[model samples]
Target: MSEVLLLLLLLLALGPGASALPKPSGQRQTGPQRNKLLLVSFDGFRWDYDQDVETPELDMISVRGVKAKYITPPMLTMTSPSHFTTITGRWVEDHEVVHNMMFDQKTNLKVPHKETLRRTEWWDTGATPLWITAQNQGLKVGSFHFPGGGAHYSGQPIQRHVFETPGFPDDNETEWRENLDTVLDWFSVEDFDLVTLYFGEPDNVGHQRGPDTPERKDIVRQIDRALGHLRRGIDARNLTHNLNVIVTSDHGMTTVKKRPLVDEIILNKYLPLLKLASFEILDYGGFGILTPRPGREAEVLESLAKVPNITAYSKSQMPYSFHLGRSQRLPPVVIQADLGFNLNSRLIVYVNKGDHGYHSGEMDMKTIFRAFGPDFRQNVVSQPFDSVHIYPLMCRLLQLQPAPHNGSEEVTRALLVQETDGASRLVSSLLLLVSFLFFFV
Candidate 1:
């Protein structure tokens, strides 16, 4: 019994080591084995955009790799919150990036686009992003214009990164090609293990001219060409087999006319009924948050309930699917406009032609997700999933332990191949043997 107890202790000590190395799912190698990853985000790329537009590069990736018909972004599908959620695998509520422009009443601080990238507290908030996690594990990570990629978390930034400054020129074809070239250079020269690339496209054009318009389709074509450049560079470097590539988007966009949902409802009918502390019109006109003064919360909710083309929810009454309302950053009362409608604000006169922050359940809010690489299964089509699950998949590909996050491997398990090496199998068997002996000896 004493000998058996000692053996059990030894097995327990080896448990962590056994799980440390991931086993290759198979011996299939299309090219040189390079364990690298690239995550690309095409801002505002809708799930169904490909139906109308021709995206040869994206289509090729889908043909050669796994394609998810759609990826449902977390609720309040704004750019900053959605992108942060993609990297952290945490809900916006948990990550604390509740909105693109975060307003903290305690400090009277408003984080605009210019300041959003610089504010560490608004981004770090204890949750570790995938880049940081990889870096912590001694993997070199790089980023080009990815949100939260420029900022330092736990006193460390990605080894290589470039941030777009406020008021930078819109990315034309030349700039897009340059961006891809830079990424390829980093991969070849710097030998980064994980890299992220962001493109603000169809989102910008989609906002100026509605997503359904030919103008947005033109931009999509341009982005598709840029993707071709990236693929060509990868093939040139012979990294196609070794490097995994995932292309996705933060949120989808929808056309919004000047319906003035807020004016006809909140301003005309509800404003007089309550004492308001502050009201924020967020994400073009699709979302709003209302903070009632002390003792006026009930009145605010009661009055806004009658608004047309809008849905209102008290913080506590928010839907479980949203996964919001748990943070202090969220306002007491939340409001969202119905599809094709937008909230009107007295401060802003120019309304965006396209908008997104509506409920994620809407099909218009869905985004595209495609991946190709050694770790991923090829020639597959998957059902829709939340973008938050992306972080876990990235961690799995890079062989890094993920930080605490809302995503689960079960959500992305089907996209991956179950490759185990002989060593991994041996360790797994030993673990099973130890467990069996401990239980039945």
Candidate 2:
């Protein structure tokens, strides 16, 4: 009788029907089951933009989940490269998306962001994106206007994606709502595990008027209201408990006060030296790449180094911290403009009042990152982390095995609740069943 009583007590302690047992010291407890994840990106949303704008929806999310003070984007903080890095968890060098407009010397191909949708070679190289990884693991994935959404990877595109229309302005409010509604519709579909939504707002307006201008603030408020609508829709459908939502930006914007023509400095001033170069690609305002003539590499580097407000580096001498020199698409000589300066051609007449693609170390180039859902701790504020860390967090929330990538678990693990072991739970269930049989017999 004593043995039977002991068995009953043990079953009560270990049974699956019992509440979760206390975890051993130093063992982290896992979060609740989070089967759905939604990632949203606001283009060029600066880290501090929220402070000046009234973002009730974002505030609610931060109060409910976790918000990073700031997130440092990868070097060459351009839209396409930063977005790809955020999804792939690798630096631009490793991912091979060196810039927004990439020129490949071997194929003599110039692939721009819009054209990249159909060009597999541009995005399919290096690490696979989160969407592809999730889809391969049997989770249905969908994207609405997210970068890298249209690429056909592993012989398949995202299950449902809205491709950007060529030359169509993406800053319209109506278009933004339509895209958000489409993503919400996707969530209602059967077994949709992951969905990505993008909005090109404040960035478009920021560029036209300047990051600190009143016009930019108004646009930010407009975007905030739109997000509120999205939140209400999710709540209406009772998905707030099941979906993990993350809101971030590709990069942040900085004011561009001067536009320096690259030709005046590189071509005209150093014409004799530049003529020796085989190709010169000065696509973005912040960075320039020069593919020198076979033997004139030293000459090109020397001449460009003399240009003011521009720092030039030979491929081998590029900073290790930037992690930019490894890709074949990189030129022999790379040039970066100092903060607040735009490097352009003499033929170009107009420049946006605001721009990005500056060095990542600039605070103005930092962006926002906030997440709210069952998988995250409520009311938590974390220190600034690199945007690359987000990839691992996404994998964890979706309960998928992360592919081998540059992201570190140590960087993002603290933000997540340690999960309990399923095996332990199974053993508890078996013990309870045996105890029940003995008692009944």
Candidate 3:
């Protein structure tokens, strides 16, 4: 009987059904940890939600879950790599997506592909996305308009959709509306173990008009309505008991106060003009950090730094405390703008309404994350966290092992079961006991 009791105790302690069993150390799982996850990312959300425009729908979701005021992004605040980091749990440099545009080192050419629809080498991602991982574990997965996830999961038993429009920034609203319709249709058809919805309008509008602008607010409202539809879908299917909804953005967008230094004419004249080795955006400016190819650093900086409205930085002189990567592909100098400055390329020179290829420090690069589901706690988390942590949090929700991510487990505290054993160390640097002591004491 004692042996049987010991076996039962082990089952209760480690098994998913062990909630009611007391730990030998006299503890229990924390509040509620999610079981299934639905992550929604709204591009170009500011980190400072308090200072940004009002978002009633977002606030409601936050009140029902945790809301982080700051979610630091990877080195390059571009959309493609940032989203890649979010799902793969790695930095952009580690994932091999240094920027929005992927260039071939040998040919010295750009590989062009549409945002979500492109499946070329330029768009190839290194980390396994949550959809693929979930499906591997027999969970049903679905995503609407999340970049990097484009149709990769399509025809694989998981329902994945993509929307791509040529020269889209000019007609973002129309495309977003059409994508919303598609998402609504998917929600209407079948029950999903997981679902993701992404909206690029806010990011697109914010890039052109700034995050707090009137147009940005309008975009937020439209996304809010779409989320409302999602909530109603939850009710229609009575999924509140099992479904977990997570909302977040890749990175925040900011407004450039100053003008661009490398205008179209200058860029066109200099691109093929310079018999240079390589060029890269180190941080957030033309001059802030520029790494020229080997012997070309001095000449490249001398030429590009001379431009007004640009700041240059040596590879060793970056401002913020971020460990980008240690690789041969890393540039020797990074360039950024002074406050309110942006870089102009051939794409932006002629357009009246323009938004492309910006890595500005002032571009309100903050993103948002809020979650509500069976596995979430009813509390507001206003601390700073990174979006890369979401990948592991989703894995925990589905009760599966996740690929390693760079973020600390403290970022995922809100996603844990109340009074549980502890967060897996691989997921966080925090000592669970220390966190508990700090919170309680």
Q: Write down the TM-score of every candidate.
A: 0.85, 0.84, 0.73
Query: Which runs of model 2 end up more than 4 angstroms from their true locations?
Result: 1-32, 106-108, 259-267, 270-274, 345-350, 417-441
Q: After superposition, how far is residue 192 of candidate 3 from its true place, in Å?
A: 3.1
Q: Candidates sorted by lDDT, descending order?
A: 1, 2, 3
Query: Which candidate, 1 or 3, would have the higher lDDT against the true structure?
Result: 1
Candidate 1 local lDDT, 20-79, one digit each (tens): 226323232222333789999999999999888888888888888899989999997888
Q: What's the C-alpha lDDT at position 356 in model 3?
A: 25
lDDT at residue 245 of model 3 (Cα atoms): 77
| lDDT to native, each model | 0.79, 0.76, 0.57
| Model 3 Cα lDDT, one tens digit per residue, 344-413 | 4333433223332344333455566778875676666757666677776666666655655675555685
lDDT of 3: 0.57
Query: What is candidate 1's TM-score against the reference?
Result: 0.85
Instruction: Give the residue spans of candidate 3 off by over 4 A.
Output: 1-34, 49-54, 112-117, 151-159, 165-191, 258-294, 302-321, 327-333, 345-363, 415-441
lDDT of 3 at 382: 58
